[model samples]
Target: MLLQGGAFSACNLAIIENRRLPGWICNAAPSGRLGRAHSSRVMSVATGEQMSKPHAPTHQPSLANRLRLGSLADDGLSYKEKFIVRCYEVGINKTATVETIANLLQEIGCNHAQSVGFSTDGFATTLSMRQLHLIWVTARMHIEIYKYPAWSDVIEIETWCQSEGRIGTRRDWILKNYANGEVIGRATSKWVMMNQDTRRLQKVTDDVRDEVLFYCPKELRLAFPEKNNASLKKIAKLDEAAAYSRAGLVPRRSDLDMNQHVNNVAYIGWVLESMPQEIIDSHELQTITLDYKRECQHDDIVDSLTSPESAMTESVSELQGSNGSPTSANSENDCLQFLHLLRLSSDGSEINRCRTEWRKKPAKR
Candidate 1:
């Protein structure tokens, strides 16, 4: 379904066709027979979306030191990270896709810890030194998108540690265009640590505080309130009654991260894949809020479902497209509000749920 808005508002937006950014592949030999990068490649420092993995308690690390020990400072400190926008990072609209933006936000937050010697490996090593292991999990994420950059648009993203509560740590981000330095997006996220052995929630220990407090900024860049379960709408289970649904997407090897599970960003792409092609061609995403419930493994077959807020009106008269299909083409009344759910096909366990808002694409001049 297309975003059914009353009027197509104008915004300062630019477009570029998705194309790979200019860069040379490193000539260094692949790390081992398994083809892992043990030595640092001389390539540009893009966001760690492709590198960082969500560590799961069920598996052992196959790739060691992907999180560099050198990246962290002895005295924990956070710093701004720069990322050159890439072609694959953008969507059909030629702007940064929501998944790419979310990945950048996630990377900056994690890299802040990595830079402060709190990487996944670093944390495991630190806790193991004391006979404990904790896995960092993103509990809640809220993102606000003011603008999106096109392919090859260099952007700087800054993330910093906020305060830690009983079980959660807060992180925030500020994104700006590299050329003009215009603020494009800001986000806030909440993370909680889980004990690897017990499979239960763990409190932020003094060790965690000691490492992260040194980098916590006094003032936040964005004034986003801390999010809890009560603040957001709950997602309902979708059965055969759902309007739009897509299925039969199996997790690929490329989809699995170092954690041996599907990456969180992959869930966003799966939800979007269920979106109607007509809606995709005529609309642009505005904002999306995702609540991850469970981790999906490599052997799982996932399904995406969306329930549109507005039901399709039965008519074949005026809302017809060039092809004999009901469409909101060129109509000011085009907007979409979706409640999305992604789940396993076998037992129907929900993996993640999201709420998304879309606006009609402005007409080209």
Candidate 2:
């Protein structure tokens, strides 16, 4: 779903509050697909306090956008660098709603994977994977949850831009369980303007105007932005992440495939090295979504990130071990791993953008 441009603010430090519910931002009711079993449902969540009343369901809004990741980060939740994964009855739950968090992910992280619509809301609302330069700012926005319990209602959702760069912009957000703080989900995403015709990254000659769209729009000409070597690492802004534990591993020739780039799935094995051995052995992955931005090569000095936000961003997950450890909770180094926007000097060219995210389902010990 898309949102409109509202406000923005950058996050300085990660937040670590014992919040039961995430803060509320706006209200949106999604319209289901045609010929579906059920379309839309008016939801009353045991979540949090409801603020303003719905103006009127004049017309089902288009995919919503127009939000900066900074505003989401500026708030105390600070998911741009961290996120919460609550161990619930069925599965872990994050407090943030899908729309708000999705918007933020578009702004803050490197979303090279096109949003290809989720299975849960395939009908009326679903995020489809599209090229970065092809994305557009959502003109209107609203979210409706047809299924519950299985689908945590986005009790409250908000968006923000964590950072803005010479060529690309970063967004972040939070999804809270209105039913209190039973769950909260946060995310970060990034976008680069492109020449609509060529589907190539382009420089922004005009101000965001005349229908600044998200899923590929038309532009005059192709102009590349001045690339830089800056990394958009905002780890210090999250509260739910633990101190990172580094590990060293030797790459096997099998890890090196054609293209000489490290095979994508090989990174998960790298992350597993840093996680608790027990969880690695016991947990069965229930839902795994890997977003591969940059490829890895054999024998490179790679840092295997098993952190939650890293796992979520990269799609390589480790099980729940540290959350139970006070040491884990207490260790807040404010060190963010630089993932995206690695620039090379000389001509200021882009090497590549690399990041990962994952979620693990633990086998009952």
Candidate 3:
């Protein structure tokens, strides 16, 4: 017998004995695949005989399952996950934007915390932290990008955290192209606890330290070793007159995260807002180090100020010693560096200080 819409064909009709009345129950299959039965159903009859209801449809995985969620690495100390670069994540250059990369790093870090049972609330806060109204705040971040993945490219990220000191912890990440297994980027960040209500920094308590250290590895493993500390050195404050400035920059509603503060990634965008267009077009960001000084709210008006390190003669000479020759001092291979400052427009209080290194873009063939 054919079912509704003639899509399913019923077969193997069986007689069932019922106290009320007799009814027919049969297995149904798609009309095209009649030999392969998929579901079972009972026909409705005039007399009340226990009607066999249709079995529930087979469970199927959702589209979100396509995304490879974070899981512990084989060594059991680090967390790793694969992400497909979505169309929206890419910029006009057809590669993932710096902000997108930063967001991914943040996501994997949070996921690592949650996997270790440290994040009871959404913000990677412990149960004690929630009770004490404490939250983690980033103090410093340094990121280096060798390559950026284009849209639809699959990239794998591995991240781990370790105790920095009595009051702080550090997290590091390594990003790679999943297709060719090429290392593309690495990032490290320092975070400290803060009192959510008082808006002041807090030291890591003994309870929190023990809980976090339990998951950290015994041996220290750094993506950026100590020898590379030159690139991760402290970013000097941009004290000179700003060469470029973008004032009245307001945070969009979307910029605020679950913590009710402008996210770190948004600050990255604001820092770039004041960058000279010629630099943006001619160079690609190689390294960026951000020292977050204060948090910004949605209503806070901001001014993004930038100054090229080359303009500071003494600083440039110190960075790249001059050999009494102009050509050697300003070689093409020499990276262009910039200092960026983001401050509140109202009182000029500093929000973030950034140092960026850029390399000349390769000429198109």
Enumerate residue pairs that collide in model 3: none
* Tens digits of lDDT, candidate 1, 303-364: 89887754422111321221112123323256567778888899888888777767677654
Kindly give the stretch of ten consecutive residues in candidate 2 with the minimal lDDT sum.
7-16
- lDDT sort, best first: 3, 1, 2
Model 3 agreement with the true structure over 186-299: per-residue lDDT tens digits: 788888887888979899888667656655777887777645353467777887499999999999999987678888888899999999999889887867989999899999
lDDT of 2 by residue, 1-365 (tens): 12222211111000001211111222111212210111111112223444344212222222331221121222121222222322241333322223223333333322111111111111111112122223322111111111122333423444433223335444433444455533233333344443334534444332332112221212211011112201232232222243444434555887663334443334444544555454434332222223333334454455443444443233112113311111111112321222222222223233222332222332232
Q: In terms of TM-score, which candidate is strongest?
A: 3
> Could you give me the TM-score of model 3 versus the true structure?
0.75
Instruction: Between candidates 1 and 3, name the one with more favorable TM-score.
Output: 3
TM-score of 1: 0.66
What Cα-based lDDT does every candidate model obtain?
Answer: 0.54, 0.28, 0.66
Off by over 4 Å in 1: 1-78, 120-130, 219-240, 310-335, 363-365
